[model samples]
Target: MDLELRHMRYVLVLAEELHFTRAAARLGLAQSALSAQLGRLERHLEVQLFERSPRSVTLTPAGEELVARAGRLLADADDIERQLRTLSRQPTAPRGLRIVAETIHPEVVNALAQRHPGMAVTLRHDTAEDGMAALAANTADVCHGWDLPSVPLRMRSGIAQATLVDEPMWAVLPEDHPLAGEEQISLAQLRTAAWVSPGPGTRRARHLLSVCQAAGFTPDIRYVVDDQEMVRTLLANGCCVDLAPPRHLPEQGCRAVRLVEDVRARLFYAWRRDSVPGWLAREILEESRDAFVAGLVRRGPLYARLVEQEPARFGPLLDIDPAGWPAARIPVPALVSTA
Candidate 1:
């Protein structure tokens, strides 16, 4: 006989509630019955899933893995059933779209909602790992992340991608530093400065290392931080020399100078290749791309203002490479967007 969904549900509820009595009540079953169901599941799977004491029950490592996988399975099952019921009522078009990004452009959200009033759009903030996980589990139709994976460790195979931006590198320095006095810095001069970075595995790391190689010397890294805001604070306080987009320059205390060469990073939008964007989803993707570019343009004024402060040393305008963008761009309608 095949394993039924009841066993999965039993495990999920137990994992959620933690206590046997509470989980049993939530599942509308007796404590003894729930316990028996869990035990049967454990035996069938040939794994110990729980570590229970009198006061509490916690999932073992194996159990934690099972619960995460099972939770996604349950959610997908529910969505499929709900979609079928919705289809029975009206088969005209898709009712909603789902998207997840690290930081969303507000204009993109507004334009998508206004342009397709019939389509409901849901947004979630995600990390690179979270976005990758969402795509793999089919929880999200698409995601944007900094790094593209070579193996199918998490994400499914055959996901198509579109690059959106080549965020140019800038050298963040203290106001008092001697190099800060220069109008245009040479690569040799910049490499000698201490570096602040996110560490070696990240795209930023790759860019930072590449910057040093081009400059003819490796840098002495003084600090590491993942948060961009924190990086600015560290640079301002003299923790380490910072490198990032010109926009990431600390507003008040520190300054940023655009590197001379192609010292930059890329951001991309990726989706399952064989999958098609459902209703207004395709339009939403296009709107997002436009908003991101427009935001960069809007920041040009900011760069200009920084130029006044330092005069000759202020950074250059970061440019987007069209070739790095999606191979198959979404077709936008002739309608003028309100965003």
Candidate 2:
């Protein structure tokens, strides 16, 4: 039995919507027809992808794995179609670069747009995990991600990477919290407090767990949220304690303290070692540096003060000198294209 691309797409949409009626409505098909299609796809794969109950539908482990792979496949198909269309219109269309980053700074995209008027550039905001997957799947030409060095990223083979930012994580707490008055609070000190977490299985959550474990106790994570602003709000309202990079400022009700532990957060720029052209890699690195620096500058006086107070903690930004706008060019390795 063979499964068509439409079958995979159907599974993806169903997995997203989780409700037969909603998925069917989105697909413009009757619920019964959608159910029949799902049944056919499952039979073809010989695996039950979802758990169905009167109240809800949820993906099984197999379904979760398939959804991830299917997303990459669909992105790759779209990229190929776009390239073919571009070539059909203009045989010598300028080469394209697709970047997948957790948060692509608009300044970076705009800078690239200005510098390389003829080249095609696309930036996608996806999770770090998805961004790396897209690079491995050839759907993205570059990926930007962050992780603790101790929790080393599990990179796919043939990927080349360069470190863009190396900075420290700061503790966020209500101004009146006992440890908030301290200049540097150790992880062990916060063990008893309810914490804001990024949720289980995510890199941020796993890193927090590892750090806490190293400090001799697992964190008491009371809330799981993905929004940084929500985390700030929680800490400010005396709801929970959390962590963020130094770039975060303590607002009126909360304080951003230094973590005594030596854990460092690193940001990386990566691309497929075999396929990326040298010129493209260099250009991307330069633009990324500009964007990173510009973002810090935009953070205003508090950020600049933090950087000044702890230049070593800020790493590469010391070289950035956003105010002075340093003239020296920081060199990145030229890619050796194997394609």
Candidate 3:
């Protein structure tokens, strides 16, 4: 029983659609040609592949088995074709790069867009776990997040990664919140405040749990949302507090404080080492991630300016103290609530 990739593909697509005409449309083949191909395949294999009735087509036992077997063969053939095409210099064809980022970073976006004009990048807003999932499925080429050193993302699959930077996670509070007056509040000290955080299983939520538990209390939670903008607005209303990478905060409208020495979170990028290319596109992407991180570091003063505006968040800007800057910014003295 010798079957070609085209035959196998026809079987799989036919089985999936259970309709000769629709499957042909999906495969970009004429309906009559598709039917002829199926007839040839069935005759060659000496198997009646489908039980055709007026309204529906059902797979015969033999048809089901052949379709299943054909799926694997078709997949292998497709893989071989993709590998060959990419390995060869196909004119004007873009090498695909699937990158999963925790959230989008504008600098990284801009930097990469300029260098990799021909590269195809599929972006997914994913958690670190989502990134690991993408890596395991061989869907994504690279994943980026804060470069946490100690947190080993050991998935029981074919994923490996490295740290790009060590930075602090910030406690985001509403501009009008009572605690925003102080330069910073300890994670433990914020126990009575209503919190907006991820579910307990998440890394951010887990860090908050560990920190509060360490500080001798469980945190008071008000909301658990995944969206960053939602996190900012909820905190900005002075109703609840949350945590995130300080650098990820809006340049205005939110107050971000470094987790008081004890509570912190880090991020990293994971990829299947073998899937990444040893080509110019990969190198350029790596460089872009590096430059974006550097630019974030250098732009601490701009962040401070946001803090000082006190239109909300960190009120009444303090003078620029680049002392330990980027590493640490002096808390702008909280704006006094005139009300």
What is the lDDT of every predicted structure here? 0.65, 0.77, 0.64
Which has the higher lDDT value, candidate number 1 or candidate number 3?
Answer: 1
- Backbone clashes for every candidate come to 0, 0, 4
Model 1, residue 195: C-alpha shift (Å):
2.0
TM-score preference between candidates 2 and 3, better one: 2
**Residue pair clashes in candidate 2:** none
TM-score, prediction 2:
0.64
| Candidate 1 wrong stretches, greater than 4 Å | 1-96, 113-120, 147-156, 181-183, 273-282, 302-339
Identify the candidate with maximal lDDT. Answer: 2
Relative to the unseen true structure, what is the C-alpha lDDT of residue 90 in candidate 2, on a scale of 0 to 100? 51
CA deviation > 4 Å runs, candidate 3:
1-94, 106-114, 146-152, 155-158, 251-253, 278-286, 289-299, 302-339
Q: Where does the lowest 10-residue lDDT sum fall in candidate 1?
A: 314-323
lDDT of 1: 0.65
Model 2 local distance difference test score: 0.77
Q: Please provide TM-scores, in order, for all candidate models, with all chains considered together.
A: 0.52, 0.64, 0.55
